[model samples]
Target: MEAVFLIIALALVLMVFAPVAPSDRARTPLRLRLARQLHLWDRYVYHDPQIWYPRD
Candidate 1:
């Protein structure tokens, strides 16, 4: 009975603290990659000093 209780307790501890393995699925899809490029020009404009002067 004590052995069974210890086993259950150990399993509960592992379940609570174990890190989940990441899935084999891709994080970003092809559609999202294409959509991200659409904002590339806007990103460059915002970050470029030539387009917008940075106040130091």
Candidate 2:
């Protein structure tokens, strides 16, 4: 019982913290998905303008 609980907890932690690579170009962490949904992920994570914007 204890081992099962520990495994579940570990899986949950990994799921929350791990970075998810989608089929598209972006790779985002699960924990920051809320911020991404709110359009604040890049603002807080990428400080440089060049990171979010590219030169044309």
TM-score of each: 0.34, 0.35
Highest-scoring model, TM-score: 2
User: Which ten-residue region of model 1 has the weakest summed lDDT?
Assistant: 12-21
Could you give candidate 2's per-residue lDDT for residues 1-56 as a string of tens digits?
Answer: 79976875575565556656656877665547645433553454467777569798
- CA shift of 50, model 2, Å: 51
Candidate 2's displacement at residue 16, Å, is 0.7
What C-alpha RMSD separates each model from the true structure?
20.4, 15.7
Off by over 4 Å in 1: 21-56
Off by over 4 Å in 2: 21-56
Per-residue lDDT of model 1, residues 1-56, tens digit only: 79976875576555444444457854565455445543664576578997577677
Best by lDDT: 2
Q: How high a TM-score does candidate 1 get?
A: 0.34
